[model samples]
Target: MEQLHQQSILFAVGINHKTAPVEIREQIFVHEDEIPALLTELRKTLVEAVVLSTCNRTEIYGVTTRTDLDLDFYKDLLINFKGAETFVSREHFFASVSCAACQQLFQVATSLDSKIVGDTQILGQLRDAYAVAKRHEATGKILNQLHQRAFKIGKQARTETRLHKGAVSISLAAVELAAEIFGSLTGKTVLVIGAGETARMTAECLIQRRVGKILITNRTRSNADELLESLKKSNNFAGETIALNELKNHLNEADIIISSTSSPAPVLEKTDFDRQTNKILLIDIAVPRDIAPEVAECKNVLLKNIDDLHSIVDRNSRRRMADLPLVKRIIMKEMSNFLVWYYSLPLLPTVLQCGAKPDKEIQSEIVRVKEFLLANVSHVHKLAMQNGAENFAGHVEVVNTLVAMKNAALTLRLEIEA
Candidate 1:
């Protein structure tokens, strides 16, 4: 009975934004080129496997003929990739089985469980993840169909909901707010502080809106210059890297200042301004507050904090939430269909036995009918002329019954073959 329980088991394990921070998540991150090796490694332990590594999550999905290895067993596989420097171990690595795992992947592909709900990138990421598994022959029929259906359902969610439509990230929300104030960013000179991921994304957003000029500044001049060069290459950005010391001289030139730096204290203070009094819009996205609180006290300064971006995030989330019911309905429908297919696997031998008996029974009946027809052939032909329509009707009905039986036999054979 213990070995019998191994049949048709599906499970998943790993860490995501909900469970781990960027530091911990990065350790398990698998590059596209690394997937084949990982697939080969996982399949050694589990019969079927797929690895989905994205910016916000890293998960290993598996199917095995062993219920003996629990979720922790799979989670340990991910930890084996790299050392556990920042991981909280059990707190960060969550494991799920069967239907729960299936639901998790579907929700992820649809962007329902993304860091920023309704992010448009998860679908493409999921497709890439599944493609790697398929190319390596890592996934069997069950997982192949599961991922394909996940893609289909993700598309259905997009069509049925407005969730993926608006500014999702803090960077995007800040950009959208800028656009609303300035009408158009085509000729605006935006000042960006720091060269971190958030600041890079924010600058990209500004460039996307056709911001006229972008000025980047950082404590280390070399880092600022390097970041500007990278951004320039990416989008052919017409931007300049300013020396941090020149912040005061150039402060008046910027229409908007968005800062996200890892600083212990406020980078932009009231003292940094005052002398250069131009109407300035400040967006501080740093954790310790990059812009000085007193900067907002300046008559010409309009300030917004990182926390303020929540309003936009909430709005976008609500848009996606409105369609949650429809998305869930499709997921449940697909789940039921797959569940029926999964449950039928255990009855394979019984189905085969039941299927063959019908064929023999039908063949025997066909043989009896053929003998009767052959014996009455001449008598039936003469009666057809003597009795006319009544005799002809009787012969036609017998032949029709024979045809029906043959068709039924053919259909049953086809089903068994399938």
Candidate 2:
């Protein structure tokens, strides 16, 4: 028979913290309900794929024969979803196939190159995304196996390396820095400029710090109100919602400002900061920067970017480094397990058919032989022979068939080029 093989191709089109702001990222975030239809639209041409949309990143992973499908077309589709203004230059984008896709996926899964290093949530999110794609039959042999293996590698990195041990999430670092600047959050007024996941995370962290008051603001008043209502559930938080237009007026009133909006440029500019009367500790977690670095020049206005958090996170990163070996061991073990299943995929049906067909043939032959022996042998000799030769020969035929198939598979594999 002619060889049957499939190649995996991965094409990702989206922006991340490195390429776009939170506003841009959020704009591109694919709603869960929209996935099936989106996949349906893409499936007409893409063959099989997975869509991974989160507050931090929106990526597409697929396997297809149409490797030449215009990336601009997909990028245009994303721009329609995310708004074209959010994208900077096209240079920030990436596209790869086979080994390259495999590498990129491994890095993402490990959180090696995430906005927050070693963020564990991403691994689970990736797994869930894969499951959804698989459930919808949107992933084929290539991506199915590659993604599964990448996921295992991610788990291995976490278990084998101290990369994630005591990881300093951006939110936690912002809270810690807030404490250093303001001494305590008990009497401080905090405003979260966006109501997305990062915004919610910042707000939650502030609430945990026992911040005296919290305010939620978003371009969408309903979103701000939604987040505010959620925060009100906590007994300690007593806060209000401010309209996006009202942000500047209350800027002076906030003791701590954490901005995670999806703006293309600085939302809180130098003009927005009032150096006097307000000691605003601004933690900008958004990419493309929500609060301009120049704003930090204002007296009593302490602003920090993502990289600044790395120093503290780095120390914690070192402590967790001790666990890397164990994590690696786990990942290696899982990878081996996954590979066994993966490699066997192509051979499984053939192997099963080989065994099954032989079993049937042997049974038929045994029945024929039994009838012939019954007719030919003496009645006294027939009983023992029926229990021995017929049964043993049938079982032997089945075993021999399996061994022969396995040997054939092994020989075929050895003959194939590495």
Candidate 3:
């Protein structure tokens, strides 16, 4: 138990918009299908792990006992996994250990660290990421506790603070940009290129603006129809579903085109809009970009990609900055609670080893045990920092011991309370 005190390190490693450009982020993005295999590989080194790969960032959160597995090791794993060794370097990555790592995750879950600080989408993203990890058996007691706590903290932050008072998601930012371009959305016709969450959100925003009409086109007509039907239930706006191939025919009629498809390649080429003479605003919010870059060169076409929405995001973030302190306090309080529980884990085995005794003797022993465990835990932390990767072969054994102790302590306490 003493040996395991500081050896089970919780860590977060990866790159975000602040550390890496969108191009690098897209290259590192782990698709849903790739997560299981990636987690399998990570299990060789990590005791517990979760991979969160969104459009704006990709991060790996894990509990590892091996001191040898530093920040560089995780960065190299990502680089090798993505086959991005040629371009991606260690500089694009960032890592935090133990308490710092825990704080980072809390901030992310509460949307404090998002590209748009008050964005409401990150909480659901974190929830989905944790669900995937849990479903795959990639998480253990530590991660299970951490993520569940995060969800509670996230909800608390949103409910108690004004962090989400006027939340502006990426999709909303896109719609705002469209409004800015056209001066008004009252008579504007929007052509939505997909029926996913982003596309739906954008449509909803546009509907609120009283946009004249919304034309939805998708690779799958059923998905497009589903979105159209949902929107119809909410609003009486003229919503129409068009075939994917009919996109070109409607190009001239659409004043603002918002494309957020998951297609691997560009769905709209310059040639598709070459015959268009009417001015059109095209916003491509997809990671791979639904519209070809060359379309920007076409006549009467104004193209904007995801990066173009930064101006609007930045402005919205500033307005939300005043609520940050409130969210920060919530995060700090939650983080402190988590760290207290985490540090107490190693003491579980020692406390259980005390065996049964008279109430008076047990009370006195508890005081002495607390002092002893604190000193030993502090010493272990110092040694971990000083030794780094040296003598780390016993990492697995340390994790196993700590986990067993934690589970046993929990069961015993539950039985006692009952």
Query: What is the TM-score of each predicted model, taking all chains together?
Result: 0.58, 0.64, 0.83
lDDT tens per residue, model 3, 58-153: 999998877766668888998899888877899998877666678789989999888888888899989999999889899998899999999998
Model 1: how far residue 233 lies from native, Å:
14
Backbone clashes, each candidate: 0, 10, 0
lDDT of 1 by residue, 306-396 (tens): 5566566676787677777877888777765554444334322333324455367566544544444444444433432233222223323
lDDT of 2 by residue, 1-418 (tens): 3232332234455567677665456556676676777777678778788888665777887655453455666666656654554543455455544333444566678776576676756887788888888899998766777787887778777766677776756777778778876778887899889998778878877888888889888989999998888767765568899999988989888888888876656778887765457577888876647887788898878888766675666655666666655654554444344433332333334433234553675555445434433342333122222322222222223223333545565467669955
Looking at model 3, the pairs that clash are none
Best by lDDT: 3
Q: Per-residue lDDT for 279 in model 3?
A: 96
lDDT of residue 239 for candidate 3: 87
- List candidate 1 segments past 4 Å from native: 1-6, 167-204, 214-311, 350-418
Whose TM-score is greatest here?
3
Off by over 4 Å in 3: 1-6, 347-418
* Model 3: worst 10 consecutive residues (lDDT sum): 383-392
User: Residue 337 in model 3: shift from native, Å?
Assistant: 0.9
- Ranking the candidates on TM-score from highest down gives 3, 2, 1
Root mean square deviation (Cα) for candidate 1: 16.7
